[model samples]
Target: MLGFLTARQAGVDDPLRLRRVESTRRVLSLKLNPDRDVDRIHGNGINTIDIEAVEGRYMLSGGADGVIVIYDLENFGGKQQYTCKAVSTVGSRHVHKFSVETVQWYPYDTGMFISSSFDKTMKVWDTETLKVMKVPDRLLPSALSLPLSFSLFSASCVLTFPCHKVPYGHRAEVLSVRWSPRYEHILASASADSQVKVWDVRRASCSLLTLDQHNGDKSKASSEAVNTAHNGRVNGLCFSGDGLYLLTTGTDDRMRLWNSATGENTLVNYGKVCNESRKRLQFTVSRGCSPEFVFVPCGSSVAVYALHTGQLVTMLRGHYNNVDCCEFHPDYQELYSGGKDCNILAWVPVLRASDVEEESDRCGRTALVNPAFQDAWSSDED
Candidate 1:
């Protein structure tokens, strides 16, 4: 009876209820560094963050108050409780006129970065000089419209450097953008007006493909008013490792997958998720697997879902407040989530055998086989 109860508690199916199950487990309170925390820079809440994986060892953050700050993530002074020191700033005097929405590293180089602002511009900046590198006009052609009851909004374009020359395209405020892993020059972007555009970055005019809701092959003009892909504002977008598919989240509290090459909607439903009506959220995909997985920031928790079938696999919960972004580190099989609580939490899967033994030991079951496994289980059971 105790064995049966333990298996059921671990989400065993009816047929396999009695058999010991090896499932992905979660440990909520494992602390990486209780002493060190992300230093706050924004007087208002932070809106976006981008980590540079190369030599500078820096992460860039944009805020609701129109400030951009670069923080050094590495320990320079060899202190136990090292605060993330600000390396440079866009200048408080000449800060963005509107809230900065996104900050991203250049696809090929580490010395350059890009940021998009509600001020209707995407500025490319040289990391060393900390100044605008390229000031190309990439705004959407749509007129600004704000519903009186809700908040004032405008359609904006997202920027990506897939190759040296080919520019990506979007007809609305590009809420999110990502590059394809298989093809270096291929990139994708989602917009508030419910369109996803793909670009080769080498072309002079017209996108390679315009993912419209209507059925047709011809690319529509930027001014054409068409039915949106989602009922609400599209807020988040990501591409799978293979780059064969794309995932999008919206203010309507849903997530959908798409066939990248064909522009066919997979229509997988993640019911009643967070309402990202205003800000952009980040999601990631795990690579080198048969059935790839996607990690989505849904309100206060990160929801892991099967990519192909679009089934909710598990919900990793730890954040005390709404989670704004999540990234999956495939090299370690770990996930990092950051949010309104002003903290980033690292989540790792608990070993299946360990969880089963722990539960069995908690129920006061005796192990007749190996005493070492029993001792190991007893330590964590408490």
Candidate 2:
């Protein structure tokens, strides 16, 4: 029966069979969004999803309910939908009192992971033990007494390991945090107080540079101490592929690019794009090529833009609800996007020669009477 189907469906043309096989390979080889509707496990929505940098075989997801799950992407059990069995959990009882804001694997290892929470603490957990690996110290400064009135302030150092913990800078809740892809010792963070900070994990002194809204002039250099590129809360930040540039998005309905080394704003404007508002609008940079592109999570669709020019090239539309995050697959020219709709969509470029030929033929001129040909045949004018 199998032999008959192969002969009848594939026919005798070897070339056609080969092309059909290649097309199927490309489609199936693309990654899936992994929208596991396992509400039975975690009652709330997923807040973060991260793919392992080295193997790309496993994925990590953190939910609003403070549940962390590890998913195996490879299908080995011959199942229709790739089953993502939960490897371990922190449990709902001991989970973060607030939402789990971020989840990231150790840059160099697979047995450890880090997660941050609105509870005002970041925890590094041993993936094998499912327990906290390191917990840094905390410090609170004395209340300042002003001439007119007294203002209160407190400081805490969240747990970050493989480095000393003396003074973790943010005085308020940390909104977003990321490790440097190149230098593992360097970490960057954004806060609710409208500040961006760079920290060297080696020392806990003051932040390397405090990005504030007021430097000098609001239009020129921020009049404040830290540079404030966004008029509202700067919720999202990402380093460019080459680590030369940093991209930021805010509630101001705009995206801006900056020189990471000099802390200078590039001022590339993305006009009136609605952000996730409350959640972090994660963005990713495409690797390779002369001109690189940034994939930004804009409302219901993902916007692809040129890095330096800030020109809007194209918009990918498929999500029924607002898109929360997106990442570019470096191995293939494919895109993986996920949203509030609880579904992930994989987009592959359609590049068949026959498809292009059909489009060209449809637009080609069919009229036989050519103006140039008629003009040449006309009798000589007086």
Candidate 3:
């Protein structure tokens, strides 16, 4: 980090390069922070959490208890020991009849947000009033609304296409859905049927691409495995920051990377991700890092993996039970994970004093090297 700063000061490197380098270092050094806590309001397991993108100062969490809570993440008191306080909650009245599967803040505005649940219903909320603004159409009778199922959100109406009615809809339940970060109309959906499909919302008659794990290699595919993205249920789906690559995890205990544009499997082997979740798994990717990282919920730990190479970076091991969701705060380079332990743990970047000390020690050692043993060619020539 010092070297990067020196280069930036000398105008020898781009300012953006220094930022990326520091961000990557911070992400790599993430550890469970003792000073930070999120108020535990959920009586049951947390299934989903989303940090608002507008200000990155507020967070939303939905739990299996059919409750939704909004937390103020900004530390206004200027203290290291800080707890994110629950500013508002939708607790008793008008709560979902079953587990709340997903909650997301409105991208352009913090005044509203949306949530869906297993109760076959979706609700849009007015953040200030903490009241249900509208209950959108009930989910399809056969469709249990899992996390990441909703397609679109607007200020007035929450729209979800009955993709089940499409020409090539999944026969089984859809487990996850993600919109491309690069393209507004392009969407991806994964299903319990082991298939991943990309759709253009404008042309909803049929999917645009059906990802094949085999990448059309006839010799590697059997009749049943021809077009499937995984051998078992594909429950997790996350797109890289640039939306060029897609990462998926399945009940088969494996994660695979895919080329989003062509629907071809990149075949970077991320070994045994150990995903057994029957519901949608929420994972996230780092935004400003060069070789970006993916934070995934693996049983009781959140597994960090390199985005392109699929190498397991590290495992965050604080949750006592199975972790259901993990979210990354890009601005702060911090991570928040929720689990069946009924706790929300914060992973923060450790201090850099040790790095400075190491650098100084190396310099001191070089200076103390024996003068007689040192090469004197340069001194002699001078």
Candidate 4:
């Protein structure tokens, strides 16, 4: 890092290249931040958490106690102790009748936010007034799955409506709701009734497509609404960073991938992902990294899997109880997971290249030297 800056001070023309290399190296050296704490504000176990995509400086957390909190993740207090302090919150005094299942900030702005709860209602809020903007009649939580929340922030279509059809929206409780990253008007949902449905919210009267497990088997698709998504309940749903593919996890103990466009099951087999919780199982995919990964909250640990290929990468073990949700920090390649233990764990990639290189030097293994590492040692200045 010093060499990169010194080269700039000395008027080297290629300093940007060195700076980018240094940034990637720092991200690869992620470690658990022992100095920072979550500031234990939630009286009960936290169910869902989201760091605003607009600016990663703040985060929103909703607890099982029907409480909502906004925390300042950055160390702006000027005190070195650096505990994340809650800026504002809506506690038991709020309108939510049951556990607050999920909380999120507007994707493009911070002045507004949304929360979903077990009480069969999802509400919008004005951050300035800290008052309920609109409590819609959505989020009728699943009989077997937890609640879902995503910011479809525009004032137009709130996921406030249940997907049912006779009228064909979700006949059962919508377990998960995610706005399509590619098209702002497109939304996808998973439900307790074992179905994954896509909605082009521009027309609330109908959905774009319904995913069938049979993947075009007329025998099953033709059955009376028997084209269930999973053998059991579909409790989790997430879109790949590019929004080109969708992923779902269910109580059937399996994870499946799909092409978001045509709603075809790509069937990239993620074998037996044990999910016992009847609540929303939140998971996230890594963005802006080579070999993207998916982080899912497993039993007492978070499971890391190679996206698109169902290979198990590693189990991030730390939490002592059932893990419920995990979110990825794309800016730093960090992972934050919350669980029944009432603890939030940060999984980080320890700087291992130096250790591996040392061992390789002792073993006289030339192949261990990656081209990037070899370049780091050989500089134009050298």
lDDT of 3 by residue, 82-155 (tens): 99999988884577888888888878789988888877667878898888785445743212232223522111
Q: After superposition, how far is residue 124 of candidate 3 from its true place, in Å?
A: 0.9
Prediction 4 TM-score vs. true: 0.77
Best by lDDT: 3
Q: Write the per-residue lDDT of candidate 2 for residues 124-207, one digit (tens) a residue.
A: 778888888754343111111100110011122442223365544554545566655555565566655566777665663666
Candidate 3: RMSD over Cα atoms? 8.1
Whole-model lDDT values for every prediction? 0.60, 0.58, 0.79, 0.71
Which lDDT tens digits does candidate 4 get at residues 1-382?
4666677778874765565454334333445666667767777777888887777877888888788888887777777456777888778667488888888777668887878777766687898888988534464222112222452212223344444655465556667778777777677878777888887655646677788777988775645655667877788989988989988899999888889999898877778899897878889988764345688888998887767667665577887788888888777667777877777766555557784345335322321432333323333443
Give candidate 1 misplaced runs (Cα > 4 Å).
1-36, 55-57, 75-91, 134-172, 203-228, 288-290, 330-334, 344-382
Off by over 4 Å in 2: 1-42, 75-91, 129-172, 201-205, 211-226, 348-382
Q: Given candidate 1, what's the lDDT at residue 230?
A: 62
Residue 31, model 1: Cα distance from true site in angstroms: 7.7
The most accurate candidate by TM-score is 3
Better of 2 and 3 by lDDT: 3
Taking all chains together, each candidate's TM-score versus the true structure is: 0.64, 0.66, 0.85, 0.77
Against the true structure, candidate 2 reaches a TM-score of 0.66
Cα displacement (Å) at residue 189, model 2: 2.4
